[model samples]
Target: MSKGQPNEVTGRIFDGATLRKILAQVQPYRGRFVATGVLVVLLSGLVWVRPALIRIAVDDAMPTGDADLLLNVFLAVCGMLLFEALLQYRVTYLANWVAQSVSLDLRSKLFQHVAQFQLRYFDKTPVGTLVTRHVSDIDGIANVFSNGILNAIGDLLALLVVIGTMFWVDWKLTLLVLTPIPVLLLATRIFQRVIKKAFVDVRNQVSRMNEFVQEHVTGMHIVQAFGREKQEAKAFAAINASHRDANIRSVWAFSVFFPLVEMLSATSVGVLLWWGMQDVLVERMTLGILLQFILYVFMLYRPIRQLADRFNVLQMGIVNSDRVFKLLAREERIEDTEMARAPEQPIQLRGTIEFENVWFAYTDEEWVLEDVSFRVEPGESVAFVGPTGAGKSTIINLLNRFYVHQKGRILIDGKP
Candidate 1:
């Protein structure tokens, strides 16, 4: 439950500080980020053009038997589709490029940060936990850029454009088409909350499985030597089952949510048809406008559905960002401050070592070495003779500065 620990699952979906940190990674890729934004905007605007061209072909060109006008509109629609496709490619490529770049930088930074951590930190933390942060969690952040944030923005813009066009064609039908939206929004809100928890559990379970597998694999020799293979296998099975169940929960949430979105979408289209058909029969609304509205209805609902999925991606990314940033926040490394400054000129090593009344402990509960004192003069061969856990290795570790002594001075060549 400590900070940076992957197993800690909280209900909150977004952390502002974590988001700011994630965005800070994009400062180096601002050009690509801006370019992707512009492309997304262009794509959103271009979406309306195709339907407008179709409306012109159906209502105006067909009625006058103007084959030339119909051909021109068809060409225009085709050109727009091609142009949209091109923009989409650029957006997708640039977004992924930036994402990969950012992830690379983050992974390197996380690795360097972890490298500077003290041996005690490694002793207390699992290697698999760090592996998850470096590998899977960073990939989650990459997805935020490539699939979550930019795509969600594009979807929102497309949704707005579709709704605006629907209203322009016929405000009454637009209002009717939107009747199911409130219900859909409610379902989405519920789904978001449920899936956020599920995703958090999924992430936690992934970290657990990683830790379990890594520990067992590294200790496989000990497992076989101690005849604990069956017990370890049973433990692994339990961890695997937990991982499976967590994934299934997230999948179940998706199954329910997407179908509800599709059902609401279908119902909206049905109601639009049933109600607008009367206007069509009376010649109050043109067949082209009704057709345009139908297209707009699909356009509007598709993005809404996608937005929910995108939000889940963003949610998972945020969860990862929180954990990764917390790991970066930890400062457990030994600090060689100004007070411990080395001499401007290199000192000649005389092979003299001294430990004066030193006290050391890996933890506060018990002392590994207490009130110890020793001196090995230059050209003297001193042997440290003791059983295991008798401060033998601790003495060497203290002299090498791997762990700082709690009380007293360790001097090299009489320099403390």
Candidate 2:
């Protein structure tokens, strides 16, 4: 969890504590959150209605020569479709609104937290790495609220409703049509496992690339002065290649999994046609019911296929959240106790400065200043002359309270 270290991928896709932290972000927008949930459930529950209406029009209205009933059913289907569209719009808008609001809040909090951190923290952490956290990682967390977890829940519910309705319509047909589902499920499980790792690698590579570019760009003068432009470009190319490879792995998983889903969907249709024709020939099932099963098969597989994708989105969000939270958890900020605060009113001073038995280190046991002592009387102009890396700047930093000396009594105006 150290700064600049790659995040470790957990065996589980979602962490409970992480999930709770994410949901906690929704507290301020609870009304929108609740409304989104309700709409998703409502939309899922109504998934079977249109198919049922289509069956009724085909079998009952048309066969009975009831033109009035046919017209009414058509109009009803149109109305239902429109209603679902409106509900979808509200859900999309509400989810994104909550997500964007939460994103803004988190970004602002992170910025303030990072700004207060000690210079030692920044010395060890790369600017590009922090940039990745502020930009790409936060975007991933936003996606969790907008399109990841919530949409995945809706897809799962719609899937169950579609399957349940299929069973109700004709249990035998449903069973036969679902024969290919086990294979599809197995494929999806593999895809999820593979893609999660790929995504984690992608994020890691992105951070590395960001860090490399940031450092090189900021030090372009050094690189040019040392005639190391080609060397730096080669290093950047290697990092960029790693990022590309990681993305290709994720793309490869999608390429394989989606085609497999389509093939399974087609197989289910074939199964339906093969078994349905037998029943139709024997007058045990009507054409209208067979057609309904076809539609139902599509509904069943569509959500199942989407479920895999949505799960990936959720997984990526969790990965990014883990990184962001780790950064937030760092205790690198200087704590200003009550005694450290400046007085409300300014007071004149004689300007005497003293550093008594000061010991300091930017890192563990690597002392930049070892038991150093100094004094500057009023009106005395003292210059700290030293070679590079000889604690000259460290002295100024300690005097300014930019860092706390490990063991020291730094007194200004005879005050300690």
Candidate 3:
């Protein structure tokens, strides 16, 4: 495989360089990101308020036996819910809008850049590989903005508020509820390492499968002509099987991760209840305060468990960004300098062509055409008679500047 080919898989995970490059692309939308962050913070605050409102309604209003206070608290909770819903909606909408805008900018730039690459690039690099980058890779980056970054931040903030409130209500119970955290964190770290590799494997396998299918379909005539259908089918089956295995590994990682998270969450709940009831019995904690703690624990674990999945999204996005940025970083090998501008009026061509001591080769120093000389005057029809690889197409290509000759003086109407 050539350097331009996409068969090589990059093994870098969580690279600072890749992260910075992706951030530079999203710099244009910093204002929207900041606004979304503010909304997330406000939403987190609102989420914290709901549990407190529940506690107040149960402990204060119910003891007073006052229907009016109960009604007011109920209305307050309803208003908060409505406000939170609006903020959530706005945050999601803005995040997705920014995501798609960034994807548009990225895809436009990628397509334009790929279009300018020399023919040799396409000769070595598969069309399906480039298509994957343009579509699949760009979509991955979009999900980073849409479902990864802002949402992860919101979850983290919500988790923090839950923890803070838990400690405020009762630090002892909070500590008890968090005893399973170390084990959960360890499990999450292992899952991250495994899934990161799995995601990279899946991406590489998908690219290979795409390249294989594309090349085979394009060369279907050759396969049929050579009577190699059965052989090709066997080859395709091997590639397809590898792709399936890669996907299965990724699914297996998810299966293990989610169940572990659920178990940890359940353990936290069990610990909170078992220890919390003792405090309630000793008059150290009220029923309402204990109920509030239980609510906070549930809120905390939900986000904590979701954090692992969000991290997977972030990791996958980073990997895709690396590939996309690598493609964009390629420099155009062919320069368009001093191109001839159109004259104010059209000038008729003399239809004369000349080639003097032309030397050319597709690769270095292995000449296909050496010291070739030819001339044809205006209105004269001429043809070069030769075997199959005798520089016939090469002459046309050089005259058209599809491939520039290494050493040549090719002139059309006396202009080189």
Candidate 4:
């Protein structure tokens, strides 16, 4: 398998709203997602309680050397930590199972559709294109449903927790931390177009590379015979260079977007630190609340970065889904009209054929046969001798139903 291309499917894919609609396939997981969410909620509560625990440790428990209070905090913290760890494990396990299931379903559907597609559809389409859909697109979609959706869930819940902890601990610090979201959103929206295009370019180049390798390997003999190996080498180098450039562009865009997001997150932490210190010295906030706020801030960022990263993968998947869906959506042609089957008691008949008023045309502008006819009865040795481009081979073609007659009926064993 090719090392699937970088994401070339970004800007042109379905919008975020549309992507969510497609993600509705995971609707069956509503119960699981909700359960996980509740776990996360409980987990957040544990996180929120830590500040108070610290306050007790620093301000209350240690103040008068209260050994009993310290022991209680230690036991409570250990219990909450264990539960949180279990929740994390459950969510991760469930998400992975869901990811594998969805990817398998998508690939199976796509394969069924492609299997039924008419010959004409595949005439101009490269096998590489289809392979990309099966391999890359399916994997890309798996990436979306797996890491993308899971991270999104975590991000959303974490955001709620962070906000809640903010208000509960220090709304002033929360306000400072979140003030950059709108600005970041605006910035993301602005660069989104470029980032999407860069990703698409990378995927396209990778696909072309796959196609190139396939063609070259298949035609190795031709290259050797024609003594064009050196020239082909240069051609391949150009393709490799194109692939490299596309990856560079994608990486460049990613570098810009991710760091900017990180910076926005960093700035929020810096602002929170400055604002919280003021409240701290003035006795408006306690040491424990500030510690919880910092942890919440750390928790807040992971999802932000995850969402951004997953968006790119989701975009790539959506792009591939279009092609896969096209394959799945195609209508079959050239099906047998009769429920034909091999007879239980088959009779072997000698080869013979007959055409009655047979007419044929490979295209509209010319008729290889026009209202013409022929008969080849059994035990009669007959030969068709005509100049090239005549309907000689066409009669044979019609007899086999390789090219069905447009007018008049064909009689094979006295059957049309």
Which is superior by TM-score, 2 or 3? 2
CA lDDT of each candidate? 0.87, 0.88, 0.83, 0.70
Rank by lDDT, descending? 2, 1, 3, 4
Q: What is the number of backbone collisions in each predicted candidate, taken in the order shown?
A: 0, 0, 0, 3
- How many Å off is the CA of 299 in candidate 3? 1.5
Position 389, candidate 4: lDDT: 92
Which runs in model 3 stand beyond 4 Å of their true positions? Answer: 1-6, 337-357, 363-367, 375-380, 407-416
Mind sharing the TM-score for model 4?
Answer: 0.79
Off by over 4 Å in 4: 1-52, 339-375, 378-411, 414-416
Candidate topping TM-score: 1
Over 333-371, each residue of candidate 1 has an lDDT whose tens digit, in order, gives 887634356879875688788899999998774899989
- TM-score of every prediction relative to native: 0.96, 0.95, 0.90, 0.79
- Model 4 per-residue lDDT tens digits across residues 1-416: 22222323444544665476447656766676567556655655555565556667776787689999999988887877787789778867766677777778778877877776654355445666777778886787777766665566666666676678677766667777788889777776656666678777777887787776876786789889999989989998998999899888878877887788889888878887888878889998776667667777777777666666766766676766655665566665445423234567775666557677767776553778888867787889888899999888887766655555678877656665
Q: Ten-residue segment with the worst summed lDDT in candidate 1?
A: 1-10
Off by over 4 Å in 1: 1-6, 337-343
- Among all windows of 10 consecutive residues in model 3, the one with the lowest summed lDDT is 332-341
**How many times do residue backbones clash in model 3?**
0
